[model samples]
Target: MAISAPLNTALRAFAMLLFVVAIAACSRTPNAMPTGVGNLGPGGGAPGSQQEFLVSVGDRVFFETDSSNLTPTAMATLDKQAAWLNQYSNYRIMIEGHADERGTREYNIALGARRASIVVNYLTSKGVNGQRITSQSFGKERPVAICNDISCWSQNRRAVTVVQ
Candidate 1:
């Protein structure tokens, strides 16, 4: 019951230091990977998996309003997709075309179909087997971003590649 003043102070300091160290040990850096888990590679999926293809090779391409033509940027993404598809030939892909909620239902459906067909054609021309790819149109039935603004409309106009 009679600890010396110096001893008491030292013990308190030691406890404070331990607390600080424990907090530091438990805190993780923003970029630190989890322990015991090996690297998941790009996109956090096994190589050649659908997840890898979606993340690493990109799964979607945006289109201009009322246009099914592929822009240079879209072409670049498609190029990467073609390379990945070629490397993973066992996978079949379905290109889903979507249009912004601007035109009539029939018009949007036709536009979406054109968008999907364009992507299929591009991939086939790049050596991906046409037989391995199919295309469908969602038209305006599906909108990834549902708002009247241009931002949402732009996002809705896209073709997404689904790998099976």
Candidate 2:
């Protein structure tokens, strides 16, 4: 059976109203938490959470396999983060580089070093003082997540931004 235009229009309006009400009922602000930073995996962070890290004393950030390039998306993400770092010049930032479990320890260390240096270089270009930023290589020593798939690999491959 075909519905009349008026009834169909009313039904759609009611459905839209329910959705808006449901979303409004569910929305709430999250409580702030201290940045354990890399001590805790990314879980440690809530969406939109900003945690400060000191680059001194060795910050731990990881990278992907044999690559020093930050992905375009990573660069965009880092740009906002770098802006924050630049805001607080007193705080030092150490970007720690890490690799996956598949490589030799030494090889991973070199790759991790490259990853951290790349971040430092980018930060320098962005007007962040080189003296305020430094880097270290954890190589494959730390794994935020460990699994045989890309999901696990992605977390393991990171450069942590530490502030002190």
lDDT (Cα) of model 2: 0.72
> All models: lDDT?
0.91, 0.72
- The parts of candidate 2 lying over 4 Å away from their true place are 1-64
Tens-digit per-residue lDDT, 10-75, candidate 2: 999999999999898776335533344555434343332344233222234434567888887667
Clashing pairs in 1: none
Error of 1 at 22 (Å): 13
TM-score of 1: 0.78
Indicate which candidate wins on lDDT. Answer: 1
TM-score of each: 0.78, 0.63
Residue lDDT tens for model 1, 1-164: 89999999999999999999999988766665553223665465688887788667789999998999899999999999999999989999999999999989999999999999999999999999999998999999999999889999999999999999
Q: Report the poorest 10 consecutive residues by lDDT, candidate 2.
A: 52-61
